[model samples]
Target: MHGEQMAEEFPVVGLDTDAREAAELLASQRLPGLIVADENGAPYTVLPASQVVRFLVPSYVQDDPSLARVIDESLADQVADKLAGVSVRALLPKELAELPVVNHDDTVLEIAAIMARLRCPLVAVVKDRKIIGAVSASRLLEVAMTPH
Candidate 1:
C-alpha cells in the first residue's frame, strides 16, 4: 500500500519542448498525460492531451485551409503561430483541482482518498519534494477490488 508500491512510471517532457514534439511523444507513447519538468528535471506541471488539442485549434478560429493559405501560403507560419510563445507551463490545464502529491511512505488508501475527493485520475508521488512516479486511479481500483 506504500506510495512507491502504487506508483507507476510515467513519461516526463521538458517544459521548453515544442508543442509539436510533445504532441508526437503523446501520440507515439499512447499516454493521456506527461509530466512537465524544468530544465534541471524539477517538476512544474502535468500536460494532458486535452490541453494540447486546445492549443492546436482555438475555439474562435476556424481551421479553413483556404483562409490559412491566404494568411500564409506555406502554412508553416500558421502552425508556428498556433504554438508560438506556448511553453508546456502555459498550455497546462489550469482547472486542475488540488494536486495530490504524497511521499513514498503514504498508504494506498490515503492516496486513493485524495484522488477520489479531488476527482483526479492520477496522483504524483514525490520524495524530498521531487517527483518519482505516479499512482493512477486505475491502479487504486485494482488494489481495492483485489482480495487481501
Candidate 2:
C-alpha cells in the first residue's frame, strides 16, 4: 500500500501554538507526537511526547535524573507553569531534525524507512508540498505485518 492508503487524519499544531495546549492535546489524545506545521501549513517538525517531557523536566534534573526523586510533588505540579507563555517553537531543539514526510504515492516501505531513519513516531503525508495526512509508526507496523 502507499502512504495515502495508510495515512490517517491526525492532530497538527503550528509553530506559534501554545505549548500548554499542545501538551494537553497530546495527553488527552495519548498521541505519540504532534505534527507541527509552518506558516503555510506545510509539514514542519514533529513535537514528540518525549520531547515535551524533556522540556518539562528541569535542566538540572535532566543532568542528574536522580534529583527528580527528591523534588516534591508540589514543585512538579507547578512545573507546567513553565509552558504558560511558551510557544511550540520554544520547545523545539535548537538544531532541528529533518522533517519526516512521504509523498502520497510513496511505497509503504519508503514510509517505513523514513520513520526508522528519523526515529520519528509520525510522518506527514504530503501532496503538492501541503500535508494531506499522517502515518504513525504503529500503523505502519500494522500494515507491514498484515498478510498479503
**Predicted structure with the largest lDDT when compared to the true one:** 2
By TM-score, how accurate is candidate 2? 0.97
Q: What is the lDDT of residue 91 in candidate 1?
A: 74
TM-score of each: 0.70, 0.97
lDDT against the true structure, per candidate, is 0.72, 0.93
Top model by TM-score, which number? 2
Point out where model 1 deviates above 4 Å: 61-85, 94-97
Measured with C-alpha atoms, the lDDT of residue 14 in candidate 1 is: 87
Clashing pairs in 1: none
Q: How accurate is candidate 1 locally (lDDT)?
A: 0.72
Candidate 1 lDDT for residue 62? 54
How do the residues 7-77 of candidate 2 rate in per-residue lDDT, one tens digit apiece?
A: 99999999999999999999999999999999989889998999999999989999999998999999998
What are the per-model C-alpha RMSD values against the true structure?
5.1, 0.8
